[model samples]
Target: MSEEHNSRTAAPASAPEKVSLWQKFRRWPLIARIATFGCGGFLALFILAVVGGACLAIMDPEGTEERAQQAEDDRAEQEEQEEADRQAEEEAEREADEQRQAEAEREAEEEREREEAEAEAERLEGMAEVPGVEGMPADEARDALEDLGFSVDFETDTEGGVWDASNWVAVSTDPDSGELIEDDSDVVVNVTRPEDEEAEEEDDEELAQEEAEEEQSDFTITQEGGDGWSETTVEFDIADNFTMNMIRNGARRDTLEAIEEALEEHPDSTRIVIEGSFPMTDQYGNTEDSVILRVFYDRETVDQINFDNVMVRDTIWEIRDGGMIHPELQE
Candidate 1:
């Protein structure tokens, strides 16, 4: 027995051999091997992905969360900016539409005003028929004629043989009553003052003698030089209606009398030229001091006229620019 045991112990011990995974796989069936390999490869890739994610999280936990938050904030900001731009665009469009509407309204209003003005002008033109002014006061007659768009020229006969339009009564009018005339035609008004019978009787002899003398001393006017005449210029400020009337009644009368007296001394004088200018109304019917007047004639004839002999009732005539006289030809 002892010899049998020694023989068993003396036998060589042999280690168990390990089987390789490739050899195991090589022993599998074709379909089973393919499935097993696929499953094993999938499992290995998933394990590697989990390990990589864990490593990244451990390296930068705060940075990863910050990057995600920043990306979300950027998207929100972009959306807000886009919304603001849309609102601004809408506001601009609304303003532009309003401006266009306002412009159209203004243009329409102007067109309406123009049409109304035209209609008013037509109505006034059609109603400009002249009316009779006989037996009316001189001022009333003038106003009446002017209301019809007619210019008025006044003449008065007084007991003193002097023309005083301010205190005269209109007797007759040129072109007569009920005469159809142009809107801007001139109308001559003849006016005379009433004379008292007792006064006339008291001064009959003296008036007869004065009349005889005046008839003998009256100067004759003739156009011997083919309507040639002497010219003079007078400038004065016309502030209002009162001043205009004063000029017409006082200054114009004195100037004409002076001219007549001067012509009496010169028998060769043919005529006397007179012209006047005043402020013109603008588009708004406002007057300004831009009027001008000029008279042109023979210089030699004007030199003989004596302006100093004239008698002005209200205002005095003074030469402007040291008595400089500018002459121009009549159109």
Candidate 2:
């Protein structure tokens, strides 16, 4: 009975207690409780918002598209500001990195400068004494270098020495020639010497005397005790430069090797030059082949060596000052 009375006492939809949200409010307030028609809960508002936006994009439905466009413009503006901020931070970071690199480079440069200065100071402070000859005679230089307590050898243009005439003997020295050497240590200095002109002059003279002596008819280069005669005849032309006395004396020799050794030993000797080869018949009909050579040397060099072929005036074989003798040619 009570339940039937309560159901009959309910208010109608038009009553103030059951008023629709639109009828209750002239405008919605943020703090006010909302009222709505009980159609499909509040889900119809969200669906309407989406459908209205889609319609507006196509046909400007209900001015919903205008509101969405405003929202998109605001979002784009915020993204642009964020991107700009990121770019500014990156630029600042790049500048800081450059500053750090520049500072490191500066420190390295200062360190190099300091090291160079130290090397310069060390070079200036050294001053020491060195002994022994300083120049280019290999044997002499070696001796000198050794005396200075240094164990060093040389490297030349060749294993021997340079051959150029105009070039001076230039050598590189270690520990510098005048530089201060370490206490009790060795000092090395490189020295070079010129070619010996005197030795060459002597060679020319000795060769000249030998040639001149060989050409004299009175001279013979035979030893005693040959079956009647066993001797060689070296006939050479006198170069236009020989004196009569030089020609006579050049026939004698300090040493006489076999025909084979003579030619092999002095392949370049003009005194041994041959015009032609032929056999000469002795009065007894014995045949002998004589060799010929040219004399082109000076007599001065021969005198220096106290050397000359033996000179023979008599037919008997004998050794004399730049002369020879042959018993077979006795008058």
Candidate 3:
């Protein structure tokens, strides 16, 4: 009976109760409780995140790679767009520069054309009117025309009764008078001798005939005894005045007269040789010496002597073309 009573009183001590997490958390102080709650919330969030990531990975395993590839494609597209934009900007700039340069060139050409037109108008305005110089001395008329800024070219009119060019008078003009002409234009002046001088020429011709009649006696026969042939050689210097007269009048009157006189003196001669030389200046600023020799045969008669042989026909043509003619030939 005493042992039963002690066992009942000592009642068997129960196994120590285990403290749950929530029970221990509830037993903490206020600050420790807050901290424990915070830590617990953070741990719970971390576990949830881990579970959500695993679920996503299981649902679509390639989702991460797709997102990365989309990001890379976005970056590449952005770079390509930027490069295209840069090129377009550069092209626009280049086009703008070219347009500006073309505009400048066009403006420059227009300005040049305007200047040329203005200069031409001014030149035309300054042109002078040609004055009449008929019936004036040839030299005086030429001087007057030249003073008015004209290039004077003189011509002799034998049919208009011109004999000596030294005292000749201008008969007409090519462009007439009161015509507006540029300074570079050529003015041709026709000249003729005074009426009084023409009357004296007839008397001179009669005297020349008488002198020829007297000179006929001076011809002497040569005894070379070669087929009974007689030859005469004559040389004459081509005077500048004579050359000029021939170029202007188209006839060497003085030379012909001298030859006529020689032929009248030696009518029996069969062959006649003539030699001449003249110096002239060409248009190219070169000095040329012209030499000529011509032989004439009495094919018909002395009165109708025919030209047989000629040397340097080109030189004669050049002289006829007024290349070797004096500027004052038709004075």
Judged by lDDT, which candidate is best? 3
lDDT of 3: 0.65
In angstroms, how far off is 242's CA in candidate 3? Answer: 44
Displacement of the residue 30 alpha carbon in candidate 3, Å:
15
Model 1: per-residue lDDT, tens digit, 1-331? Answer: 9999999999999999999989987999999989988999999999999998788788988887888899999999999999999999999999999999999999999999999999988766644556777768778888999888889888654445435555667778887878777788999888776553345566997899898988752323223344454333333332235554554454345334434554555545544433344566779999865534323334454555455664432222232112212222111
Full-model lDDT for every candidate: 0.62, 0.47, 0.65
| Candidate 3 local lDDT, 1-331, one digit each (tens) | 8999998999977899899988887888999988877999999999999999889888987996788799999999999999999999999999999999999999999999999999988977858778888778988888889897889877764554434445878878878888887876899988766774576688899999999998753223221214757665444555554455454333243334434555665666555544444566779989776543343434243444333323322233233311233344334
Task: State the lDDT at 205 in candidate 1.
Answer: 78
Kindly provide the TM-score of model 3 when superposed on the true structure, using C-alpha atoms: 0.30
In candidate 1, position 133 carries an lDDT of 78
Q: What tens digits encode model 2's per-residue C-alpha lDDT throughout 1-331?
A: 8888888777455745666856656465634534433334567988998888677677855465667788888999899999999999999999999999999999999999999999877864543445434445555555565665567545444356444422433255666665556534654444344544355468899999999989534322222224533223334332221453453233322122222233344333323211212244779999776432222221232123322222322211132122322332222
* Candidate 1 ranges with C-alpha deviation above 4 Å: 1-54, 127-331
- For residue 227, model 2's alpha carbon misses the true position, in angstroms, by 64
List of clashing residue pairs for candidate 3? none
Worst 10 residues of 3 by lDDT: 314-323
Which portions of model 2 show Cα errors greater than 4 Å? 1-59, 127-193, 197-331
